[model samples]
Target chain A: MDADVRQMTWTELAALCTNLEKACTKQLKEEEARAFASLASFYASKRKAQGDASLDDLLALIEADLSTGYRSANEAANYADDRGAKRALLWGEKATKLLKSLLARYAKQKEALTADTGVFVCEICGFVYVGQQPPEVCPICKVPSFKIHEVKKEAI
Target chain B: MHAARNLRLCTKDCVCLFICPTGATNTETGQIDFDKCLDGCRLCVDACPSGAIYLVSSTYPAPQPKHPSVLETLYSLVRSKAAQEDVAHSVKEGSDDAALRQICTVVETSSRIIAEDLWRESGYIIAQSEATRALLKAMISEHGTMEGFPRTEVEELLSRLS
Candidate 1:
């Protein structure tokens, strides 16, 4: 299994896990389906951790990128020819703002927050919600609860 | 073109089993054998009750070139997402709590998905395309020296795409 996994690309492995989970669910094997889902997440984490970058370096890089994204979004929004394009760009700008604020908060309160609260990200708009449960609807994009994915420390 | 099945939408209707002339639709493996599948034969695609089956083109159009500024922003965004994935991994490693670890996994996965999307947007739409190959080569030469860059994986991807 390890040899097979090592040979497969991350995308292929993810697809295989997703299909396996679906098969298990179709067979009414709920526990096995959940196990496969967890396995998928675990493998994803393992792949993401392959490099030697320190957490601080990653945080710093993200901060710089977010700042750049914010600036570009603002520029795009200003020049957008159509109202719809401008609105969408503005939404992106707002999302970047939210992400920057979240990153700042996380940096300052990492230890305390990691102890109890889980981070939930809105899949639609990148809104970060730090709490035991995500809001009923995303405040930024108005997506329903199911769209808010919880980020935990480990797979169940 | 060959038939493909989306496992999520497949309803076990078994219509494809009978519709496929080459017996390419195998439910046991949950895959449609591309070699066996007849080109332009979309019987299964039309027959699947749940609309799970579809035809994929064997050839892809050339990727349109992205604007320089757009590519720059996308590259930065991709880097950001990649870094976030690493941060999630680090957080997951630092914690022993099962729930927290699970959340970290979600974070990592989300970052990866976003990075892939950014790559797709930057004209890397077809894995076998020359544009994708050029982009991968450029990434290897440009960012390969960066600390903690996934140089090996990028090289492997370039070889595969070649």
Candidate 2:
């Protein structure tokens, strides 16, 4: 797995991780699950070895591209004078802002944060909030406490 | 093009109402009536105190499809994200921990959204790809035989693409 991943370019590896991400979301057959596990391990191993390499930057760039959807949606809404489209874009913009904020926080505190500290993400909107406990209500998506989930910062 | 209000951001200052020449900006709904709005008039957009109003075009030109390689990469990502979402769903099912369950659900939802976004970017969405024209043509030919298919719209798009 290591040798295979090593042979690929950083872009290719990133693409693999991205594809794996989507594949993991769908209902997986046992064979696919094993394949996913192998790929996930390979990705993790590569990232650990590379340490702040181009792959890391590529992932960030990919995540940041979520904003493009908001921009286009807003433009479409404006063109057609569609209030529903605009409202959907508004939610999307809020979610994007939350993602940016979470990323910024993670970057700023990467050095200071310990393994024990919790990173909460809102289930309804994917809003990442770093702290011991999730917020009472997600500021972005307005999901309640039951909807907030704590994840390892590394996993996020 | 005309100005419209995002009511969520509107502070109800009524500056848009004051600035709009055609009285398109209304206090009741805190929205601009598109029928009454003057084309290319942006007075309300410029004068909105809360920055809630902005001008937008009524229609946009067809967007060129991205490079084939870029489109392929996006499609690959869409599948990848779907895979991850499945993993999250499975984890959510077994987890007794509330926070963990919540996190898994969120991951699943977000991954799906990302996957859909990539799919849209991968030359499948209308107004963003010539591939859409082809797809429309194929779908109409295959499915239009069933009934209720908007064969006319598909025909128009095919002609436009040609």
Candidate 3:
């Protein structure tokens, strides 16, 4: 479903999740789970170790958590809907509750990372960097992060 | 050209309506469609003559705090190590904790760098319109160019969401 488009059929989504949950947990269905897991890798893999990784590793855990949470949700929602699928709407309702909790936790973590530009200054000419950390040597003053002044003063 | 800004400046002379080349500049509505405008054509931007039609590039995102001074990011990589230090200091007692903590740090630092890159790439806004300009600006800057950003693994979720 395109998120840009509004509205969805709760029954279809819940059914998808139920099948997804089953596929994710059992050994016979491991390959199917792996495929779904791969879909999730897009969001999870960015945070993994790399030559010049930026996001702290927490992204992967959240990604993984979302996968499981979603799978669990699909299963529960399916159960709720299965009484003749009349309960399909209820399943979607449950899914919302499940996701909101997860979203709140993720939001807190994301807020911390994005609260500021995550920039700092060179102690010398007071040069600032917005990426990960200050350079090994300040291009301007040829000083180190140690020598450069940190913008964040301890509000003493 | 200053669609929204000129909304403030227009004396309702409606001179812009006559000067605009493709009618890309709208006086009554106070909007200009960059997508509709020719690249580097500067007709509307030039037509405004109010100096209000600030030539805007469609490539970047919405305006941000302290637009990207590539110099700044380079400075960070060259001077700071708070990210590395944060990683080093998080000594998890258990194996799982250690691994989880490590991943968290990696994601955090990566997001920070990405945020910087995104901020820089997305900071171009128009002085022209505001109708959907601000909305589109937020969409573009956070999202990216109309041709759009690459389908990187990092942005895969967003792509899916879209």
Per-residue lDDT of model 3, residues B110-159, tens digit only: 32332222222222112222322342233335434423233242243233
Highest DockQ against the true fold, candidate: 1
* Tens digits of lDDT, candidate 2, A14-80: 3343443343333222233343344334433432222222223423543644545445545555665
Off by over 4 Å in 3: A1-45, A48-156, B1-14, B27-31, B38-40, B56-162
* Model 2 Cα lDDT, one tens digit per residue, B68-160: 444433444444454445555555555555544544454555655544444444433332234444544544555456444445544654564
Docking class of 3: incorrect
In model 1, state the lDDT of residue B125: 46
Candidate 1 per-residue C-alpha lDDT over B1-162 given as tens digits, one digit per residue, 9 for 90 to 100? 878888878989999998889899974679788779999989999999999988877566776655555555555565566566667777777766665455456555655555544545555444556754554465456545755555665565456445
Candidates' TM-scores?
A: 0.57, 0.45, 0.24
Superposed on all Cα atoms, model 3 deviates from the true structure by an RMSD in Å of 22.5
DockQ (0 to 1) for model 1: 0.16
Q: What C-alpha lDDT, on a 0 to 100 scale, does residue A24 get in candidate 2?
A: 32
Question: In candidate 2 chain A, what residue range of length 10 has the lowest lDDT sum?
Answer: A1-10
What are the iRMS values of all candidates? 10.0, 13.9, 21.9
Please, what are the lDDT tens digits per residue for candidate 1 over residues A1-156? 011333334443343444445544543445545654654454454454434544465457556655676468346434433333334334444554555565566557655665777777766555666779989987766878887887656443
lDDT value for candidate 3?
Answer: 0.35
Worst lDDT run of 10 residues, candidate 1 chain B, spans: B117-126
